[model samples]
Target: MKTNANAIAFIMEGRRQRFRRWILVTGSLAALACMLCCAMLLLGNTIYPVQEVIRALMGEQVKGVSFAVNTIRLPRMLAGLFAGFAFGIAGNTFQTMLRNPLANPNVIGITAGSSAAAVFCIVILHTSNTVVSIASVIAGLATVLFIYVLSRGRSFSIGRLILVGIGIQAMLNAVISYLLLVGDQQDIPAALRWLSGSLNGSQMDDLPYLAITVLIFAPVILMLGKHLSILELGEQSATTLGVNADMTRIALIFSSVCMIALATATTGPIAFVAFLSGPIAKRLVGVGFSNALPAGLVGVNLVLAADLIGQFAFEVRYPVGIITGILGAPYLIYLLIRMNRKGSL
Candidate 1:
């Protein structure tokens, strides 16, 4: 009786600690994201005061402030926030589910697929944004399916999936380059901007679908978080515990791909937000806690923050993707070295 009571108390204590940790990490990330969002709105060419920014957001007719805040800043900020959250969640889901940090959409060709479709539309077809977005989503799903088919032998192999994805990404990149070379020089600048992932010229009209995609799919992924955790316990163990690993993986991949594709369509695949958010969230939240929300928040922070730095950190402005790519490259190198050392490559 005494031992049982002690065990019960210990379990309760663990639950409490986990709850507290979740609140702390998530709360901090949320706060940082809010701060960055506000900064994105307020810190432009002519800095708007807080009250004026609020009035603009509230639909007031304050001439200059309203025009700047509502017409320009608000849409840009929303694009970064929503796209960042989607990228973060999707990337984190892939990495956590696959049990490999390098399994992010950015590294594994999912974003490349979306990019290829959008670039083809822009450079070859001269299509509308809606058409480009649809193409991107379809291409992303098809790429995932292709990778899965190629990687499947008798059972799923993470190594084969990643290798095949990398190869596909390379091929897609080559296609993008060829399109750029043969395409009209007048359109090359636009194509380059899209590839570099700029939030410039964001319109309020373009946000609804991306917002809806994240809203519908993010919850599904979050709801499956427990199953994802179970799957982390190896295939046989998960099967013995009555978790259908294949079904769960398919659901996760489908949901995550939808969110990622929409985000790439919206912001042109802002680099490294997906690849970096999960590890940062895990470090902050520690083990044995759900890092999904925190990871999303981290992504939001990274995108908004990188955009601000790109805009004002240097004399010449750079796109958000360039800054993030610069940040992610070092981490990628470090990861490769670490993996090589461990003979996990």
Candidate 2:
């Protein structure tokens, strides 16, 4: 009885520690994200004071501050914030569900599908932003469905799914290249810019859909966070734990794909935010809890910070995607090497 009591006490103590660590890390990430958001609004070409920024945000026209804050910086900051959160959370969901760090939308062709659709809209159809976004979302859903179908031949296999996704992504990327090659010179620039994943020229009118999608879907992901953790423990174990594995995975995948698709439409597939956010969040939060929120928060920081760095970090201004790509590529190489060493790749 005493030994059993001691074991229970030890388990409870471990839970308490994990919970505390999660809270501390998540709180820190949230606080940092907020700071980055503020920095995005404040430290643009003209460094407006916080008071002026506040007044500008509050609808008071403060001369030079109002137009810059309300028009340019506000929209840009919002795009980075919401889109970052969407990419972060959705990316984390995919990684967790697939139980592989490489199983992100970026790797598995979901973004490529959206990017291809959006590029087609820009290059071939010469469509409006609304058309591009809608097309991207539809294409993203279709791409995931196609990938799932191709990989689900007999049973669900992670290796098969990833391989199929990589193939699809390569094919879609080729399509994008062909579209770019044949596109009109004037339109090609626009398509190229979008493909690089920038926050420039972000408009207030274009934000509502992406924002609303994130707002509605993020909670669903969070609610299923526990199921996500269980689903990571293989199908049979998940079933044993009372988790409806298929239902949970379907829900998670659908929710994640939607948010990520919308984000891609809004920001043109911001490189590796999805791939990097999950592992970083999981590392920070440790075990025994869902890292979805932390992952999203980390994403927010990455987008906002990367945007800031692109704008001010160098002599020539770069797009957000370029910075993130530079940041993520090295990590990808490192992850591959480590996985290869462990014979897990």
Candidate 3:
């Protein structure tokens, strides 16, 4: 009877600790996201302060700040926030399911596929945002399908998938590089900017798709999240526990691809947020559990912070993606080395 009481007390304490951790991390990330949005809304070429930005948002006449903040940065900020959320969650899903930290959408060529297609459209076909979004989604799905088929031999294999994805990414990146080389010099800068990923010119029209995609998949991600956790305990063990291993994998891959594709479609595959968020989430929350919620929060924090840095960092502006890549690449290398050292790869 005493032991039972102690176990219950222990469980209650653990739950409370978890709740406190979640509230602290989630709350901090939320506040940071708000500040970043406001910073983006206010700081720009015309230089509106936060006060004016708020007044403008409140539907008052605030002169130069009003037009720029309302008509310009607000939409772009929201797109980045939502896109980051989608990438973070999707990336976490892949990593958790495969039990591999390198299984993120960006690392596995999904976003690269979308980027390659978008660059092709921009340089060759001169497609608008809508056309590019549609094309990117299709291309992302096709690329992942190719990788899956190439990797499959009656069962899923993590190493094969990662290798094939890296190969595909290299080839597509080469194509994009070649296109840049042969393109009109005038458009090359713009193309490079898009390739680097920026929320520079988003509009209200983009929001409908972004909103619809995240809203539809958020609940699905939550519902199936536990199965992903179960599937991490090896194939035989998961099957023994009555988890449909293959079906779970396919669903997770499909869901992750859709989320990443939709996000890249809207935001031009902002760099490293997808690749970086999962590991950070894992670190923050400790082990023995899924990292989806913290991953999504970290993603929001990364993009919001990067966007703010890019906007206000120095004398010159940098793209958000560039800043994240610069920061995330070294960490990725470290992760790879650690995996190799521990024989985890």
Candidate 4:
């Protein structure tokens, strides 16, 4: 009896520690994201020195700085912060649940779906940003559903999901190429720009849609985090413990898809923050944290760092996505190597 009691007490204490770690890590990431956002706003062309920017935040009388901070930079910074966080959290959710670090929305063609749709809209359909964004959301959700159905032949398999995803991605890339080839010469620049995955010209209009979507769906993602942790222990064990495996998987996938779709709609599929952040977060927190929150934090950090680097790293500015792809693709290789070396893959 005493031994059983001790075991229970130890487990309870461990759970407490885990919860504390989650809260601390999440809070710290949130703070860092905020700071990066402020820097993004204040360190641009026509930067309003830090003092005046702060005064503007506190509603003091700063003239040109207030206009620059509140009018111009604030919107872009807010867009990047929220969109980065959404992609990170959503990516982590998919990776942990599938128990595959490569199963992020960006990896498995959801972002590509958005990219394809946006490219088609920009090049072929000749639509504005609003139409392109809506199309991207619809296409993103549709892509996930299509992949899920195609992968459901014998039994649902990760291998199938991944294969279909890769196939679809290749096909989408071809279509993008074709569109650019045959597109109007004038429109080609616009389409090519979107394909490079930029966060430039992110106006206030882009924020409300994503902001509301993230705000509304964020609670659902948080609640699903507990299910994700259990689901990580194999589907059979999860089902044995009263978890509805199919329903749970569908719901989590849906939540993640929406987050990715919304973010891609705003920021043009900012590459592998989704693919890389969760595994990195796992390394940081060791085996204890499978909650998806930490992965999202790491995701936001990765994107922000990449964006800042892209913005001010050299004479010429690149889109945020290009920089992240360059950095994240290599990090992904390293992660796979380490995982393989340790027999963790």
TM-score of each: 0.97, 0.98, 0.91, 0.92
Give the alpha-carbon lDDT of every model: 0.91, 0.93, 0.81, 0.80
> How would you encode candidate 1's per-residue C-alpha lDDT over 281-300 as one tens digit per residue?
98898877678888899999
Model 1 spans > 4 angstroms off: none
lDDT of 3 by residue, 181-230 (tens): 87777778878888887877778888787778788876677777778888
Task: Summarize candidate 2's per-residue lDDT along 163-203 as a digit string, tens digits.
Answer: 99999999999999999999988998878888899999999
lDDT of residue 94 for candidate 1: 93
Index of the highest-TM-score prediction: 2
Backbone Cα, N, C clashes tallied per candidate: 0, 0, 0, 0
| Model 4 Cα lDDT, one tens digit per residue, 109-154 | 8888888888888888888777887898899889999998998898
How many Å off is the CA of 104 in candidate 3? 1.0
Tell me how far the alpha carbon of residue 97 in candidate 4 is from the true structure, in angstroms, after superposition: 1.7
> In model 4, what lDDT does residue 235 have?
93
So what's the TM-score on candidate 4? 0.92
lDDT score for candidate 1 against the true structure? 0.91
